[model samples]
Target: MSHPWFARPRPRVLAHRGLLPADADGIAENSFAAVAAAHAAGAAYVESDCHLTSDGEVVLFHDADLSRVTGDPRPVAEVPLVELERLMGARGGLITLRQALEAFPDLRFNLDVKAQAAAVPVGRIVARHAERVLLASFSDARRRTALDAAERFGRGIRPATSAGTATIGRTLSALAVRSMPLVRRALAGVDALQVPERQGRVRVVTPRLIEAAHACGVEVHVWTVNDAPHMTRLLDLGVDGIVTDRADVALRLVAERR
Candidate 1:
């Protein structure tokens, strides 16, 4: 059976780190304001990263450290939840995984577990909202840990998930040799492949990859694409979703194409 997360129409636009306004505002990516903006822009899916704070709270943040976003050089894990909230208060509202899920009841989330410490907690939290959540991570182990935690805590209800880097590599290798069985094996248990259109130089999302993913009942979602032309090109290639910083534009493009 298809997960409820995939019940929505295809060619979905996932708001990358939520939506940032064009004006030079203090709003930060992954902040509450950013998420609200994305929701206001009509994005059904919001993509964000998760990290554990010093106080063991799961926060929606991208980088491991606060240097880029807050000018604080300390790592997120080194700061307590209260301090982190204070620091983010001036920039934008700091949002926790629970708060986001509760605030945005209608919004589906694509959460990337960036820290090992957050895996178990994130899984436990999302298990209650599994039907509307999709978990992802670069580390297969971390991703699996979260999924397992979700099942353990949520009484066997696991959220949808995407392929990790190692899985993607194996699937690519299988595709290179035209091994459909190997491809299916690599994609087993994953609902989607959220990957870059290109990794350094090699193109990752090709027609063949898309075809193979669809054949195995997996969806292809390219990440961080912001331009309209590239979005159009990927849509033409039959990608199931586009993760973009410009959700407003992507939503418009998808509407126009439809």
Candidate 2:
């Protein structure tokens, strides 16, 4: 049960999209430069999103369309990798999944399968580097599809995975009833549960939930956290990892805790 993802220190600091507001010379998010910055900051984990281009190339990008990042109205799946690189070159250059794995050999990546088309390719790539990758998505089906692809291509070892939304719901329901058997079964094969502290008006990540996950030997990592005090609070609550846009501060805080 000793997975490679847990080899690092507890209360992991996973850089969200490789840290934001990067150097003026680098792209702000999900760019190679940003990834380098996170590595330089001494972060062991980085969280990013994946999408497939029109030509079937997998790139590390968030959002279905380019409007937010590039101010272009084109969907990622509609653009070819060559043109997408050209479009993103000045920003920080487009980084493919393979490039990321090759470029950061020592870094562990937590990748979200952003597009349905990206699932299999992401799996094929991660399958080659199973020990250092964690595959995830909002859709359980998409996550499973990627795992299946990895199994087919990975020579049989599946990468670490966090629970998707549906799996989370099932696990939470099992927890509500205090059913250990159900909790164990619901969390089967999941290495972790990465979720926000809250959804809409409902609060997640309560003490009981954390305890339940810990009992199953599964980690609880909360995402998109940016403030130091809030990070401290979550850590105090026994979260195994923190996924944040401000990894610089989180790193310092973790050191302070030590």
The candidate scoring highest on TM-score is 1
Report how far residue 123 has shifted in candidate 2, in Å: 0.9
Candidate 1 lDDT tens digits, 98-131: 9999999999999999999999999999989999
TM-score of each: 0.98, 0.97
lDDT of each: 0.95, 0.91
Residue 60's C-alpha lDDT in candidate 1?
Answer: 99
Residue-wise C-alpha lDDT for candidate 2, range 26-45, written one tens digit per residue: 47589877888889899999
Minimum summed lDDT over a 10-residue window in model 2 is located at 19-28
What number of clashing residue pairs does each candidate have, in the order they appear? Answer: 0, 0
Error of 1 at 242 (Å): 0.3
Candidate 2 root-mean-square deviation in Å: 1.3
Model 2 misplacement above 4 A: 21-26
